[model samples]
Target: MDNYGGHIGQGRARDSQARRDAVTVEIGYALCSALFLAVVVFGVVAGPALAFELSDTVQGTLVASGATLGAVLFTVRVVSVLNRFAREGDSTDGDQPSQPGRTNPDS
Candidate 1:
């Protein structure tokens, strides 16, 4: 029984660590994306005004890069928000007791 309890505890610890790892990865990705976007935008907007004028090719490249980055960040944010709402809806629905006479629309 003691050994079984120890195994259960270890399992819980592993599960907790997995969750932490997932969160860390998510944060890292978000930070890297934001940093990249900031750098690209700054280079395009500030670099030219500061006397470090970029060539036409470089300017166009920067503009395209910034647009792509902005789109990707926007999509990620929207998806995460939608996922959060979905998760919240699921939990709330689960918490509610079902009425005997009523049927779930989802079911």
Candidate 2:
């Protein structure tokens, strides 16, 4: 009905399916990267306690702090990554047509 004659595909369903697949891939990537980041952060924070003979209290504190910080970072990373994806998608939505199409019924 509009210019450029719809997307060059079998149908809207195909495009929708492709988009879903792309989103799934991106989500998987985000989660995997976030987990890796969390693990690394935890290891760095707790490394000294684990390596050297520290007091029980000190070790526990370090371990707990590490876990908390790692969890926070993991959450932030995932949210930020997904937000970025959403923002990028916003830009490409609804192709901008040079030639206007379809007049308003009321107007």
Candidate 3:
């Protein structure tokens, strides 16, 4: 009984960590998207000062691409984290019916 209680505690911690990770990923995604927009604006407004032979169009495109890629990756991370948390939570909750013939001690 003591061992079972310990396992349950560990499972709860894991689920909590997953939820935190999901929220962090969401915040990161939002920050990256905002940064991408800021970069585009900076490139347009400070093009003359930057003088890197990089056209505003090219800079804008690159920034937009980076932002989009970051957003997609972050979104995937957030989804995965949330899924993990839910899976762990479900396994921890004994209210749900267990699968047939499977020895999922946590479920």
Best by lDDT: 2
Model 3 spans > 4 angstroms off: 1-53, 94-107
Where is model 2 poorest over a 10-residue stretch in terms of lDDT? Answer: 1-10
Q: Who wins the TM-score comparison? A: 2
Which pairs clash (backbone N, Cα, C closer than 3 Å) in model 2?
Answer: none
Model 2 vs. true fold: TM: 0.78
**Each candidate: what lDDT?**
0.60, 0.84, 0.61
Stretches off by above 4 angstroms in model 1 are 1-6, 52-107
lDDT of 3 by residue, 1-107 (tens): 32456644786676579768876876676566655655555555555445666877876766666556655655665566566656765575654445756665543
lDDT of 1 by residue, 1-107 (tens): 23445643675576568757866666566567666665666565545544657787877766676666666765665557556645754565442345667754334
TM-scores of the candidates in the order shown: 0.43, 0.78, 0.39
Give candidate 2 misplaced runs (Cα > 4 Å): 1-9, 94-107
Q: What ordering of candidates by TM-score runs from best to worst? A: 2, 1, 3
- The Cα error of candidate 3 at residue 45, in Å, is 20
Give the Å error, residue 47, model 2.
1.1
Better of 1 and 2 by TM-score: 2
Cα lDDT, model 3, residue 8:
40
